[model samples]
Target: MKIYSLSKIAIVLSVLLIFILLGALWRVSAVPQTSLIVQDEQFFEVKPGANMTSVLRELAEKEVIEPSFWQSVWIKSNPKLANIQQGWYQLSIGMTLLNFVQKLHVGHVVEHKITLVEGFTVWQWLEQMAATGDIIIDVSYDHDAFEYQFTPLSKHHQMTIREGYFAPDTYAYAHQAKASDILFAAYAKQRQQLKALMSEFTLPKFIHNEHELLTLASIVEKETGTAKERPIIAGVFLSRLAKNMRLQTDPTIIYGIGPSFNGDITYADLRAKTPYNTYRINGLTPTPIANPSLASIKAVLAPEQTDALYFVARGDGTHEFSKTLAAHNKAVKKYQLTKP
Candidate 1:
């Protein structure tokens, strides 16, 4: 009887231990796995001063992570999680709980992008930067302060930051980046691009320095609608410069008029004298009229060897080039005057 009682007690104890082990295993498996979440990707922000409970609640609300008894127990056990840094985070589906916590703790935030287009004016670029909701813009357009910011990049002693000084491209930054920081990056990129191009190609005789090259390039960019015509247009401008003839370019006349220009360039506007009016000025404009692409800059540096000194826009996206005034006039009559 004593042996039977002892055997019964041992059997009961063994069964109790087995049940306890099974419960422990179930709890471990219930902790959230990456595959358990339905969302493929999520962008979340933890505001400054948000506590751990609030963050977990917000995550649960977004359906990024589910709230359960096991998750709550996990959070309570890991007290260090409450100190997770606040910022934007991109979470992928199937991310393990451990990995997710690690990312938040390390403050691995998502980067945002902004693009500055080629041929845009400085004012236009500023407008686009201001439109980006995430950036903090403190730069004012009222004075020459912004121009002086780029003094380090200019080779000319008198040259300040001009319209074509910033490289046009997409740039990525962290959340709440300052506008000045973005502008400086663009300026640095443009300087680097110019340096690289100068090293690769021999500059034309008419382009004495970086300032002249950028000024002519901006005009070339505005004059040519097609990519292939950039070199030809550049050649025409260089030819005019060599012959001491007035550029007489319409874009320069319009630029001189500023906001008052109502889209129409009249004979009077051409006759009017302004710093940007190439029609009246004997040489290139005092500064770049607009930002030029790297290709346009390259075209100006090494223009195609051609005798063509004139071109007329055909009203189609292309232009007709001519070596003499008579041919140019005839082409203009056919393409411009005869257009129905």
Candidate 2:
């Protein structure tokens, strides 16, 4: 070899580096176009315990991509990216082969959404959760199962059943995610939120702990149609609890009736005595009738200073609050009865 000066050697090396960069660009650009790769399926599932080599082979077998020997060599060179994550990967209509590979490399798996709505019972949530596809549920949904899932939370509060323990919100999870994990997440979130609320506000005798707070908040959640009305509704329930008046919230009776409720609340249902029928029971329900939102929970802690002891629906998904039964009955007559 001929001896070269440092400047000339640097120039030669720079030229070779440019050529290598171009080759690397070509390596990726030469792959398949940005198509969904979903000729017959919408998702590509990478089974658990699969390695990068096996995943590449599966992709090649499907004709999604055929990594040439050089490309394979390049992949092997990146040892950090040698393992593929496990989950179902969604292939959009405009996804490219490189985009798909990047998703597989980074564990950007397909995400499924589930909503735990406020004022809906745990049983309803389980029904919705269990009905979802690709969401794993290893255990049955029963009293014992719910108790087991809520044991961590029940250490402090009496959650004999996993009722108002779950925080109401929309959650996203990858395919093969456990439903129980989501359940615990919701529970843990509620615990954190309740703790925060308790720390923020001083509790009254009527509201003893997180369990009682959620119990009253669930009633408040069901009582109001408008979000702004939560504080007022919460105020009415708290006032009633303070004065030894029965809660008499219709939602409690509906919950007590369970699946037999036919979208109508009759006098008989109000008269029926159950642990949840606040019209018949004293003070708060033994447990939450349904999952309440944080707003409802906060509404209980920092209730609107009002003497309103009752509220009636205003026919337009609003409420008319009153300090006395006379005003409440008038509101009921105007809104609940026919437009006279």
Best candidate, TM-score: 2
Off by over 4 Å in 1: 1-87, 90-102, 142-160, 259-261
Task: Report the Cα lDDT for residue 213, model 1.
Answer: 89
As a TM-score, model 2 comes out at 0.76
After superposing candidate 2, which stretches have Cα over 4 Å from the reference?
1-37, 57-81, 93-97, 130-132, 137-161
User: What lDDT tens digits, residue by residue, belong to model 1 across residues 28-70?
Assistant: 5566453436466666788999866787788788776767666
Task: Show the colliding residue pairs in model 1.
Answer: 34-94
Candidate 2: give the clashing pairs. none
lDDT of each: 0.78, 0.75
Models 1 onward score TM values of 0.71, 0.76
Each model's Cα RMSD: 6.2, 7.8
Q: How close is candidate 1 to the true structure, as a TM-score?
A: 0.71
